[model samples]
Target chain A: MIEIEHVSKNFGKKIVLKDVNATVRAGEIFAIIGPSGSGKSTLLRMINLLETPDGGHITLDGTDIRAGPGLTLDIRRKMAMVFQKPAAFDENVYDNIAIGLRMRHVPETEIKKKISDVLEVIGLSGYEKQRAKTLSGGEMQRVALARAMATDPAVLLMDEPTANLDPVATGAIEELVLRINREFGQTVVISTHDMLQGQRLAHRIGVLMNGIFSQVGTPREVFALPKNKDVARFVGIENIFSGRIARISGGVAEIESDGTVINAVTPLPAGTSVCACIKPEDITLHLVDGSQTSARNVLDGRVARMTAFGSVTRLVVECGIPFSVLITWKSAEEMGIAEGKPVKISFKASAVHVVEDTEVRRP
Target chain B: MGYIIDGLREAFHLIVSLDPDVMEITALSLVVSLTATCVATAIALPVGTAVKFTDFPGKKVLINLIQTLYSLPTVIVGLLVFLLITRHGSLGFTGLLFTPQAMILAQTILILPIMTGLTISALSGVDETIRDTIVSLGATRLQFLTSIVREARFAIFAAVAVGFGRAISEVGAAILVGGNIAHRTRVLTTAISLNTSQWEIGTSIALGILLLAIALVVNTGVSLFQQR
Candidate 1:
């Protein structure tokens, strides 16, 4: 397990991370998701002691790495990191992977076997003699991954491994990540800005925002129950509205935004300004006036727009406050949902998670 | 004007027939310059690698200073060596003023800065990712540097060649500290300077040809290595 305690870092007056803490257990795939420049890379670097923290300590399996022992190489070799860029050495695939094993003094036959095995795992077998620089970006990143896993470290840290890859390549890498985690049972911590990728790959997820982990839990917990408005925004909550609480009773509050009143379950005092977050997938749209369901909030409005979004269609309905709903195109055609058509959008009161804006606003 | 062609003809004659006098001077020059370059590289490589891999206050200023010294005038270096080994000067007890040792010392000093500056540039030009990947791959500090040396081997070999070229072609320092003594401390550069001053045009041109041949060999090797 890796323990990060009160880790803080800064460059000049710009704070990259502040008082961040998290524990990554062994054999679990952990994903850290955040916006760009949100200290995701910095936190991964701190774990390997590549960048020392400004304030706190990180312990690996019980050893305080920052202490004065100087077995830093042994500690570093215990884990491996793959950078966003394809950082292969100026050599062929065989030599590039062999270097890490050689550093550990692995025997020659074992090193050759390990290189071939890692290449097979990365699906680039028989490319031993190819110069790594001549390969394409996706291929080179795979070679870099093979090199990282060649030594079989106890923990694997990858920073945005599939940031700009095509979908086919992204799917390949995600499958590889799952295989490594399941087969080797080596702890994995991957940093990504894609929430869907985080949800798909991570056993546990950490929402890193403004140098702080605002929430850490399973993917379902983070996606459905974000702790703050900022975390919700980062985790793809498109329907966020701000309003003052108008009525509060029995653990529910009615908030008014853009002349639309919304009822959310929260214990906040009435008249306090708060933001309501609702997932786009949570709001269901129907073409009829059938509001006879268990839902507590329903609005009647004209369909503002509908567009095909990959596997799902994104439909927006305007009822004073526009709400975005994601449904399959099959349902869109069956219900005859289209632009300028009157439709009804409904979601449960429990689906509306409320959060106060604690971050300072820029003028 | 006719003497230019005649000098070239005589140079070929001396080189082809391997005249004993010219051959001895050629052999001594090769030995001295080769020793000085090899020794300087042994000293400079580590210094350059240290500067590349470690952080220190005023490191940039120091690097710039070393670069400026790369074009330092050889006569000033000769004068410094002269003062150091003169009879009235500091280390005159061993009588190394006008010997092959003094010439080697001067040539070593002349090429040290070149070797160090070019080495730093070569190693620094290596991809920054190499360091990060090596360390993350579990390399100790020493192992990390060994990996860098192997990665930057081509550029480093070029730097050594450039240093050797500079050392072998230098005349000012060699002349002042070696006194151009025949069959003793005379090298190609110093002997060429002497023959040129005395209007021994044929002999000087012959020595110049030899010096150019040595430099060509170094540069040819450099270009071929860089192509890899």
Candidate 2:
């Protein structure tokens, strides 16, 4: 387990991270997800001790890694880092994977056995004599992974390991990461800008924004109940309306935004200013009245725009305000959905996530 | 024109026949220069690696200074070694003046700067991420240094070759410090100088051809080694 306590870093006058804190549990994948330039790489580097924190200390298990003047080599040996760029020594694949073991003074025969095993694990068998420098980017990255795994580290730190790879290559590397974690029970801390990847791989995710973790939870919690508007937007929530609660009745609140009242289930009191958030997939579209759908909030609107993304088509419907709706391409085609087509959109009252609007308007 | 043609013909004949005097001078030149280059590489590589990894107050200026010495004049080095190893000088007790050892010492000093500077550049050419990766792999300090040096091996090899080229081709240092003593300290360059001055143009041309051939062989050897 690794614990980051109030860690901060700055380069010159630029504050890259500030008072960042998160704990990575043992034998579980912890992902740090953020937009570019949000200090995700810096945070991972700090955990690997490649970059020292400016204001905080990190601990491995219970020992403060930076406590003593010269930290023991055993502590560092327990962890290995895979960089954003694929790096290999100017040598053959066998030597590249054997380097870490040789550094630990493993015997030649044992080193050979470890190299073969790691190569098999990374699915690069029969590549021992290949020149690592001549391999493809994805192959070289796999070799880098093999190199790290040969040491049998307790913690594997990966910083956007597949960012430079193509989609097919990215999937292969992601699968390898998952397999290694599950099979070896190595604690994995990976950082990525792709939120979907975080959702797919991490047991828990930390949403880093503005140099700090804004939200930390499971994939379901983070995607469904984001702590603020920034996290909701980052997590791909497209429908958010700023409003003030007008009244509450029977554990539900009616919020008014631009003369459009939306009913949602919330414990916040009446007359509170808030923003109502809804996931695009949660809204159901109907060609006729959606009153039969048993949903609390129903809005009649015309499709303002339509955009197709692979198998799913997104429709931006303008009711009182614009609402983004995601529906299957087949459903959209069956309904003949197009721009300027009138549609009724309905969602359950419980689907609307409400949070206090803390946005400061700049004139 | 006829005399020049005759000299060329005789030079080719001497080379083909492998004249003992020419062969002996050629062998001595190889022995002296190769020895000096090996010794210089032994000293310069570690010094250059040290200068590269250590950060000091005047590191940039120090690197610039080493680079500037890459073009240091051979006569200056020859003169400096002469002053130190002459009859009454500081190192005179060792009696190294005007010997093959003095010539080797002069050539080593002549090429040390260039080799050291080139070695630093070679190490610099390695990617910055490689350094981080090595450290993250739990390498000890010694292991880290050796690994980085091994990564930059080809470039360092080129540095050593350049040092050998400079050492072998230098004339002023060989003549000044070695005195060009025949059958003793006379090498290809100094022998060529002596034969040219005495109007033995054929012998000088033969020695010059042999010198160029040696350089070509060494360069080819280094390149082939790098290719593997």
* TM-score top scorer: 2
What ranges in model 1 sit over 4 Å off? Answer: A164-169, A248-253, A263-272, A281-318, A325-351, A356-363, B1-23, B53-61, B197-206
B-chain TM-score of model 2? 0.97
Q: What is the DockQ of candidate 1?
A: 0.61
**Model 2 chain B weakest 10-residue run by lDDT:** B127-136
C-alpha lDDT of all candidate models, in order: 0.88, 0.91
Question: Could you tell me every candidate's TM-score relative to the true structure?
Answer: 0.87, 0.93
In model 2, what lDDT does residue B43 have? 93
TM-score for candidate 2, residues paired by index: 0.93
Q: Write the per-residue lDDT of candidate 1 for residues A112-206, one digit (tens) a residue.
A: 99999999999999999998878877888788888889988889999998896778878888899999999889799999999999999999999
RMSD (CA, Å), each prediction: 3.7, 2.4
DockQ of each candidate's interface versus the true one? Answer: 0.61, 0.73
Query: Each candidate's interface RMSD, rounded to one decimal?
Result: 1.0, 0.8
lDDT tens readout by residue for model 2, A1-363: 898999999999999999898899999999999999999999988777778889998899889887774774677788988888987889999999999889999999999998889999989999999989999889999999998898988899999998999998889899999999999998899999999999989999999999899999999999999988899999999998888899999899999988888899988999888889998889999996443778999889999999987789989999989999999999988888889999999999999999887883435
